[model samples]
Target chain A: MKPFSTMKLAVAFGTAALAALLTAPANAAIVLGGDNGWEVSYGGFINLFFTQSDFDSQVPACAGPTCSEDSTHMQEGLLPAFHTLTAKSPEIGGLKGTAQITFAPDSSGSKAQRLNKGGAMIDMREVFFNVSGDFGTISAGRTLALFQRQAILKDMTLFGVGALVGPDGGGTSLGRIGFGYVYPDFRTRFTYKTNDINGFNLEVGLFDPQETTGTAAEETDTPQFQTEMTYTTGFEGGSFNAWAGFLWQELEVQASTGGATGDIESFGWNVGVDVKMGGFNVVGSYYDGQALGTLLFPNVAQSYACDAFNCEEAENDGFYVQGTYTFNGKTKLGVSYGESNQDGTATGAPESDNSLWTVGVYHDINSWLKVVAEYDHQDSETLGNEADIFGVGGFILW
Target chain B: MFSKINIVRFLLALLVTASWSPLARADEDIWKSGLNLYVRLTEQDDAASGRPVPNQHPVNLDPAAIANSLIDIQVWDKHWFKKDEIEEVFSPEQARLLGQQLAIALRKASPGQDIVFAVSRTDTKFLGFRDLSYTAGRAFYSNDRLNIIIGDFMRPPDKFQERATSSAGVMEIKYYFRHGRRDDPSDFESAVMTGDGVEVYNEGGKRRLDWLVIDVNRASAARLAEEKAGEEANAPVSDEALRQEAARFAQERREMRLEMARMRKEVGSGQTGAESTAPIESRLKTLDELRQKKLISDEEYERKRQDILNDL
Candidate 1:
């Protein structure tokens, strides 16, 4: 099928490229003791996938009319190769502090380019410090946003490839981003997380806002406000996690050419649940919002779709359901289906829809290594295109 | 309408309420008192020195060695106390009975092995019954010494009118063991009644003491001789045979080491994937099925098929 628009694809890839690197399991760190009770840890993983996709219609990657319908390449999957360093200070006055930094590099360039220089560049994704005590934790700096954080973390495709952006795309793949939920891209923020109370905890943060319209003179009088509430508990035979998150931001926009002057208020809410029983895991999530855009918050293209004189808010909603069963505690087989839709505004534009089906098998060779095989079928009603993608990869962590 | 000012006020109120909630108290309050017993068995004489190994000081016991030779380790927590507080919880009568049962089980399990039992108690507050005094008793066994250390809080001794803390009680028990052994069973009986800090007992003295007799000669001479003969028969004979046996032993050791390394990695990293013998074949079969169903073009299928074969 025809691929997503250039702006949408860019937003999706940019969001995933920055945030997906930090999705590696945190417990696999190699810790080293330092003087005065300071400890340092190194962790992260490298994964590469050989992917092939067959499309039903021409995509951006096709520059000629006689271009082939299939494209094959070796690239990073949903997650790029990550290298992280963390430093933790001993508890002082009942408060402990920690600082972490991470670098993510992709492997998606051509052979000739690789010979001349590096295959791809690196993205500094996480640089944050946290102070925690009986009062809970306060974090400041750049990190993954809280909205839809749990939904993406619980996604089975986090460990495998879900959807391909394009034939020659770099960075990371979109692991059910638009199909299942909006991407909670990483951003600089100040957040406070309360200590867990009977398995219930809350997180509230003020994030740096993004420009909705690239061509407009936009002003944000207040930071984007976000909050998430999560509850986790374990029963006799299994455990489950449930969460709800909310987002709100208001932007005063005036066209650079002095044609439009109005306010666009964006608001979104999402709820999700993950249940793990024995070796079986099931996940379901849904999100709804107005002027929230799809794929990423305040999508620039969607904002442009609005009338310049009087902006009419566009409504978006999506849901995803996934189930996975781990066999013999080592091999996991999963199936996921999700769809995202954006309804036309008052101007009466045709609504657009994106949906995908993913089936994957993840096998652990050992604690530090895993092999993954995935197949994805993606469809776009707006573009009237369909694509089938197959990928195989493995991950290695320190 | 959900206004920004209203939303901000609501979130602030929620945060304030959550922070002041009683359930948000320090997590350390979750700690509770319990009884733990560890038992290990080793040769009375040191293998390298060929001399009697000194008894391990209760606090200086090597946990790794104990784990390697462990006969048993039992923990009696609140869950067990809930079921049978009188019999399972730590008390003078219960401790004595537990000591008796453990001595019997170990003697039966390993005949002719020297046994030692050491017990120490720490006073603590128990959950749900904070008004009632509680003691966390830790007991270890090695060599031939059987020492039982009771907390003064259980039934405060007349000498220490004030309830003794855990540290003071531990020190008092250590002093009794260092002074000398009180091998007589009557010594323990009297100490228990008088709320003494320590009660010492040994396997020496009359075998029929306290209505318990451990007959070490359960295995007859005929059975012992047969076992000796089987051990000798398995011994290597010629030099060539000995060399072969040595090589086989080395190979087995290497395999064991590799398996242990793999297990350690798995435990450290987390869960691992299951073993699959023919991943390539399975992948090929899947690709063929997709092609048959026309999900992929013939050209695409051939290219993927070639790629899989190239890995071979």
Candidate 2:
């Protein structure tokens, strides 16, 4: 199935998944089919961030009042409220069973101008099952893409802010996503993750191949291959986690003349490190790829390129580094700088380069509530524009 | 689009969560609740709103405020308390100041925790099944080591106090115990504590909230300041290691408790059996002498004296 249809199917499946999960009676374990070891629980957070942005003021205004025109309005932060349902089965024959369903209702304004006015549509993000024991864990289904998984999850801006102002505001803080690293869009796959040998973990998987734009035709039939190796250890003052990720996928785009662009290979690799000592934390991430867009682990044809009858591969590389200090336990102050540059592929082809410098402060009030404020200065070489955004938001995590 | 299947699914989910009650939960209550408030409405009110809580009474001048702190009942099992289950137990006015007051304290103690298991789960124990009363008051987990807060109280000092004999005001105690550490009867101290608690509120009087401030008597803290302190000198360890160390530390603690009990019973007799007037310095000197005589090793001497002084 095409990626777009598969996404729609995922949404369809997600709508019913949460009902069963959220409705499960509050019991220590939701044993089914006499599964004594089965345990189920639900957890999630609700976040809403209102923002105001002042672009270079060079771009012309829209002719009429349209939902997309308003940049100074209440918008959902990059990460919307998400619901997770988890079930774990006790060790049976030395192996345990794990299943999870994660869904985030669309709060972005893409469907409607007023927030929440666009009735929520379940965006099922993760639905997977796994069985594991001492050897390791092998999982199959839909979940986070292996590439750049650690970097993005460790991105503090994930819990803070990043990217465009609205319509959807930011769908799960892109945190330098399109600018520093390609968003590792979710994919269906079968994966194997080794149990930590010492403090090192290794994961390798086969993913469903995606069709990139500008290709003459769909040609490759093989699955995409990806792998990640991470090392985690703790010392006197703090701890550190570092990882490297790589992925390769073949692409084919069909031409209108019923011809094919034959075959093109896309490959990307990312490396990142996270370190913390006392009240301060530092994160650095860098990635380089061919045929990969500047930011996204790329979900669109726009990120890559297409020639007369073939897809043109481009060299892309970007890096993001952040430093943050925690105040007592309730508040944190942080600043980050990042840039993503995609080398031009053709004569006069747009050379896309994007960079962002940002500072943010977050305060956790009690256990359920949090308040955050951030300011971002974004420059896009491709668009030849710069935007400054200031935003403040609150979230209730249950 | 309100598809029939979607509607049916939503209904089923709502019913399931609605039917759940932690008190009537499965073998393992997934709710992970604090203090068991499972009692009659009248008993619940008395435990919650009653002045001079039965055994754990406050020494703070403002008893009402202490009452509020000990039992800030937000939401309880509706099935359990039907008659006295107030919809609005704490009015907005009462909780407003409490909200502001506890914000900084909670942040400091729990840090990133949105749900402080320590403060939220500690329950009021009025369960008088004498034989099962142990099961009623505190819900202690074996794995729980590093200071699982059991709320605050103004304890009555002197020999009557369950934990301490000093009047360092109403201090909160982090109950530390092992499954079966005692072999005899006279052991007094449960755990040798250190460091006073964090200062929650010490301003004048009316608006006072005592947070985690565990300063055991200053005199002992001063005298024992240089008793070859071992535990204090080590790096902060994991709660698991601490619990293990705490369990092994029980043996010497028994000796200290027995020795202190014997000394107080025989030598220190006052009109009222209150705190010992003897400077803890004297006790440390006695411990030093014991170590010199090979009665106790240096490690045992330091640990026991620390426990004895904390008990004092």
Candidate 3:
């Protein structure tokens, strides 16, 4: 419990710090190396927001004692602002390569973390490198997970508040994450991507696998494997880019009794699309598979129990769809909805059907300032409560 | 992590080699490679919308040096339109028509440039309603007019999703310069002050980026200028020197004007005795002709007229 709480606080503070930093005036870039060598620069942004939530009091019949959801507080936006250091090689034979490090910290308590006070915690989010040429670009690092990359990236609430995952704490909103699909946490891996093959291409990679509950990290000998095939076509008016991706990994769990000790397998797949036509943009994603936990993959629900010689697996699936339209280049209106659930197991209880719906508007006041307002409704059968959250905030990027 | 180490090692090694690249030359030519040390420094300034480099400032480069050491290397290109397919897009007829249209429009604003020949059109998805074409061709002032050979045909293959400039039908490209200097000394000074700098636009062709980039041409001549601003591309210039040059030019202009007045008076006085009486009258007539033809303003003609009378 302490570890979970600490991790949550870390994420909250890291995101808040990013938001606060965004509000700071643009500063001089940190440059390393010299005039004819490698050059590196550092930059990032910060976002802060305020929310007012009035959770519905209705509880399911089997609801437990913990059912509070209403809250009023300042919180970080859906995505944490991260500072990054990008280094590049001086040109040699017309080709160059780049390496980047994205470091972010979590805020202490206040969502605003005004003046960067409240003792924030640091989170090393990503480190990656790429060497590009006429052939293509190959990248290796502990960066964003490949599965459902475009869906979450293109979400209207990507930088806005939605789903109220942490209505009480300034943690973070699920933002259709738990409600529809699992979180694709950053993973250590390598990927190979092709150049635009007539506006279409493919990406494939292998990632470090996560160990299940009661199992050591070494228990899983094999790495997770994944691939994504994307098709993008440009029409007279706009363009459409769609992708299908799949991930598979094996996990080992030690027997609590004497049954679930053999190697277990987890596999999942996802499909998504992004369309930008005129001033309108639309995005949709759907995912399903076995042993894919509801909130985040390889989560507690994904753990299986064994009875001497028998083991039971968890089957899971979910999806989300969203649409947005830009008006006059300054204002954008958007809406999104999603739902996800896990099947009941023979040895454990079934996961609840979680659903979330969000509506928001964002306005770019200037190059540095963006203002947003959103309303979200969340329903959970397992948590046994429905919550509605209203939030408004501003984001600054420097 | 080892990958990162290898990248650092590679960068270090390349640094050793880059010191020899023409980018290090004292008089590097940006028209050849584009990436130069001076430009890199200016590109790093992100504090304001205004960049360090001034617009439409002529940067002088040694043609002999360029011919000897320049190597044309394209660091960036999506190759959306292949070389063979370019003609299909920027056809001769298209270039001519666009160039003629620009000639009609730019005659006053851009007095030296007559046409925009380097023709490129908007992509089907280029977020606008009209079919506007960009004049990526180079504009050179020649024979008292700006002459652009429209139809260079190898530049800016579409991609203007933001500023849609065409209305009704496709209007010719407008001529504009930084601060609207119009081929003046201040304009050249602006260009020289900042040197040549290029911004690394976040081009999205690379699959590994997971991001998007916005790019624009920073060169004064054309939108499809070299990718990076070359190192030491501009001659070492000081504000004091520029002031001196302006003063010298002013002095020269005054002497030339006075000399021209003397020549006109001599011509009016006639080479033979028969026309000597008609000199002043003829000179006045000539001054009025110059004014009526708009060759000189009222004040300039009056000044010349008084100078010719004084000569008598």
Candidate 4:
């Protein structure tokens, strides 16, 4: 109740501020402490969804081929809605400040929080502050990495399934971090854009280990550092976009069980190309990371295999090509086919190959609203065969 | 086998026969009218048949000097004609024979007035078979406009009923001069003093209007005035500089008056009708005779040719 009331107040304030901003002249002086100086923006979406899949059941070591479409259940529920209130400060000495507090209500009770269960939830997301200027931008808060900016920036609709899953297994992931991966630290990074030397742009980022925990002065047993460099090239034809990025991290952590004391070096590299030609847009990516040293194996056990010699390196490489041809800007038909292969070099374990295919139609009700219905099928040779899922959802943003 | 002398004589006779044919036709006479008009629809060399370049000025209007009146109608297996020979020189009767047939053929082949037709033609000093040909004829009514043709009827429509001539001259309505003189010291000084009391400069009698004489070749009352003017102007321009200028002008003007006094007199007098046509027609037959007869030469002929090409 308290949240709802605060949201209503925010909506009123934001509406008034927007009206003032729209009416003000570009060079007009704003009243510092009044509605003229303060801006609030409110946005939210509600979803009613039903999902029916065929292979929702769990099987143990089934020798025969199983249909992914079976063992599916149909459910209907009112998913929790997401809303945000953003406040921007009046320009002070050519420096402006922006702070946003977002609220995504969780309606999917405890069952929603459990593993491998279908329930509706809000998965409260993103609260951050940003300041930008001639000398690049410094965001002393949480944010999606620069690598992920293209996806969120280009996503037009407030409601619809995205091209990739969000970290919370909702929303769209546009060629960014995968679902279930979150950067839980306040990352401070500086980026220097090298001059466009021959159509190539180089950007490098360094994330400090202490920015997130508010324990900069405290000392610990092990220190970790993560650094990444990305190089991008623009095509002269204006249709194709490509980027290659490499990430390296050094972590000092105790062994999971005992007193193991060695520096662990992890590395991940990805190269991606996106092409938008007439009537079709296709994207493909290849990712490889240090397998045995950092990445967890695909076993049901909570403990990692102990033997470095016997353990297979964490090698998961997957590529997907999705094409969507817009009949009009508002209506599109999309088809995607992807296959991911993960092989562990350990004995007695088979190589795991996962394949996923999807076909969907998306309709934009308007700029801020859209509806997407998709049928997705996945086959995991390592995870007991297959899974089929069908979902329809939409969102709104203003 | 035939003797060498007889073979030589036979070959010479054939050469003489070819030479005689075009000169005989040239004696028939050619006349020019007034101002050559051209409205170019395409940048095509063979405007009638060549492909048109895209998105350009689809229409052009130009006024050109008429070069000849001979309309070369090719007859096969009769003579070994030079590649430059474009039109057949014919007497009025001979011309009427071919012209009428062509007119009828033209009317049947092209029904619209938009077909290409010549407005004027020209010829030069020595002529056998002219490397170039000319045909002029266009008609204008109260409701219609002027149509001038120079070459092949590359235009899509319009066909005319008559022939073309080079002596065609045009009347100037008004002339425009830029306010400033060309950026040269001599030209600037001369331009400063050319004006009368008024600010405007007058250029009424700068050039010899002798083209007017060639345009109307008929012995009308107007020809008497032109003859008198010609005699006074031709009063032996003795200054070397002026004489050189006059020669240049004469060389340019000669194509329009192909049968000027000398050539006309050679054919028009001192011989019977059949023999009279032989001089001009004989020279018309071969490129060698063109230089040998001094009608046009290795130097002047080449200069004239290059000039016409440069004009093109």
* Predicted structure with the largest lDDT when compared to the true one: 1
Query: Which lDDT value does model 2 have at B119?
Result: 17
Using DockQ, rank the candidates from best to worst. Answer: 1, 3, 2, 4
In candidate 2, position A13 carries an lDDT of 67
Q: What is the DockQ of candidate 2?
A: 0.02
lDDT of 1 by residue, A100-170 (tens): 78777775654334421243446777788777777777777777788887777677888788876556566
CAPRI class of candidate 1: incorrect
TM-score for candidate 3, please give it. Answer: 0.53
What are the TM values for chain B, all candidates?
0.19, 0.18, 0.19, 0.18
Error of 4 at A66 (Å): 12
Q: Which regions of candidate 1 are displaced past 4 Å? A: A1-33, A58-68, A110-121, A213-216, A256-258, A348-350, A381-384, B9-312
Off by over 4 Å in 4: A1-38, A56-60, A63-81, A106-124, A146-238, A257-261, A291-304, A308-313, A345-351, A381-385, B1-312
Error of 4 at A398 (Å): 3.0
Tell me the lDDT of model 4 at B221. 25
Off by over 4 Å in 3: A1-33, A56-59, A62-69, A93-95, A107-120, A257-259, A300-309, B1-312
* Better candidate by lDDT, 1 or 4: 1
> Sorted on lDDT, highest at the top, how do the candidates line up?
1, 3, 2, 4
Candidate DockQ values, in order, are 0.04, 0.02, 0.02, 0.01
What is the DockQ score, from 0 to 1, of model 4?
0.01
lDDT of candidate 2 over A92-210, digit per residue (tens): 56677677777777455543433453445567777877767677777777887888876666666776667662323434455567666777766787777766454566777767777
Best by DockQ: 1
